[model samples]
Target: MRLFSTSARLLFNNAETKQMRAQLDETLKLFKEKVSKIKSDTSVTTDKYKNIAVDLGNGNTTELKQISTIALRGNNINIVAFDPKQVKRMQTALIQKLGVSATLSPHNTQTLLVPVQTMTGERRAQQDQLMKKLYEQLRNDARDRNSISSIRQKYLQPVRKRMQKKEGESKPELKKESEAIEKLVREYQDKLTDLYKKQ
Candidate 1:
């Protein structure tokens, strides 16, 4: 004699699987959003330069765009500060952050002239390292948020409780359900790994 009729078992399995998949889909959506944010933050372009934080020398920091207008010239980027007093400080900040020297434009005292340099092999390697670090952080965060143990506690525990099963009892169907959840977890983990490699 079976504990549940075939139809009853099917309905239970379907409901539990649907619930688990919905959770997984929500997690995947959040993971993609984080990946998008990382890409936006790490982009190497004029917009990124404009967003770089500059120390204001009064124990405060502000973005370059807050005080200056950015313009691109042939082989150079011109950062013209709104305040003449901010020009020197802005130049120092740019030099430190960009690892390149900058000069005050002779034509405009408030303008800092920064020469554009191509990404060298060393710089490319450094960027790769940064991307690796960011990806690792994202993976760790995802794991913390959706670990197998936590999922079992949140989802499987309820099913076990409703079945009137003792915590120590090893039910075959529940075991199979756990394995299925493990497979789902692995699928999402592989997706994250693939995304990082493409970055």
Candidate 2:
């Protein structure tokens, strides 16, 4: 089950990264299975780090750039949200998807959590929702692009076949020209034979 929660415990609680990891090997394996590419939170690579989709239950995700820490929680994951409102949304998501029993307070940050409300909240929420929607849209576009590629391949296959047929049809004429050139060379000391050999 791809269950999830969020906490900044990685930032706080001084959780031994390896101790936490050692405690949760099975969970790690499950995530490795779902996401094709997994980057260690601390490791540096030559390529740009592309965001990955972790299936937090009920279609919630840690796709946002604001996710600062990812901790294992039971069979789920705790995404330490850098955005304050995202902290609340994480709680709400867990409660809705799993149960009220599943809801857990985010790891308290030394950094303040400013409670956004009213107009500001609406705008931020819209932005977050749009980000999620945009992720989905991009995925759909990739799928569609693959379909278009296949369709293009399907249409182009016939054209390729026709070109191959034309090439085949001209092969005998090419051979005849080669043979006639050879005959001419045999009949007369021809410069054309030298050109043919050079060609």
Candidate 3:
């Protein structure tokens, strides 16, 4: 069953795949009966099962129910083992039974495959609003930068230039005042950038 779950794509061709799915649909009626043998009536198995068969003519099947979560695309399969330890067990079983190697996908993302048409209109609207806000923030940041630059040029830069031009006795005092004006500009720039990051 593990081998079938892993390599249903490679093992079964187009015709077999279709036959297998049809057989699974037929067997779904007997799911309650089959599952009863493995799990007693006391244990609750409320979870929905997705079962796929590898063979239809032979009546040999791969069951996914009670073991792992399975998502099947045309030839692609995604399995999430309920027990992490079962992963190694499945790999070993596949290798020993079929003599074919299996590669497990790395778990970097927690994305799960779901049915189509699950998205709501509200969710779409929220995404659209978020993008709009982001673009507005970027535009405001640019405008604020220009305004800050203009303000520095208009009020602060001229005073700094005058202070810098003074090359006589009070040159040290003038330089100190000029440095303070530059510091204020830098602080304002930092504050604006911080606000941009928040947005």
- The residue pairs that clash in candidate 1, if any, are none
Cα displacement (angstroms), candidate 1, residue 122, comes to 4.1
Ranking by TM-score: 1, 3, 2
TM-score of each: 0.52, 0.20, 0.26
Best by TM-score: 1
Residue 36 lDDT in candidate 3: 44
Off by over 4 Å in 3: 1-146, 164-169
lDDT of 3: 0.43
Using lDDT as the measure, the top candidate is: 1
Instruction: Please give the TM-score that candidate 2 achieves against the real structure.
Output: 0.20
Tens digit per residue, CA lDDT, model 3, 1-199: 1222213323223564354334333333233243343233222222223432222125544544445666553333455667664555444444555454545765512212222222357654554455445434432333443344443444455546655664332545555545554555566556545544443
Candidate 2 — which pairs collide? Answer: 5-78
**What is candidate 1's CA lDDT for residue 126?**
64
lDDT of 2 by residue, 1-199 (tens): 3321223211112343233323233322333332223222112221221144334557767643345455444433444567645555545544454343323445563121222123345554554454444333322233442222232333345434544565433444434433433343233223222322331
Computed on alpha carbons, the lDDT of every model, listed in order, comes to: 0.68, 0.36, 0.43
lDDT value for model 1? 0.68
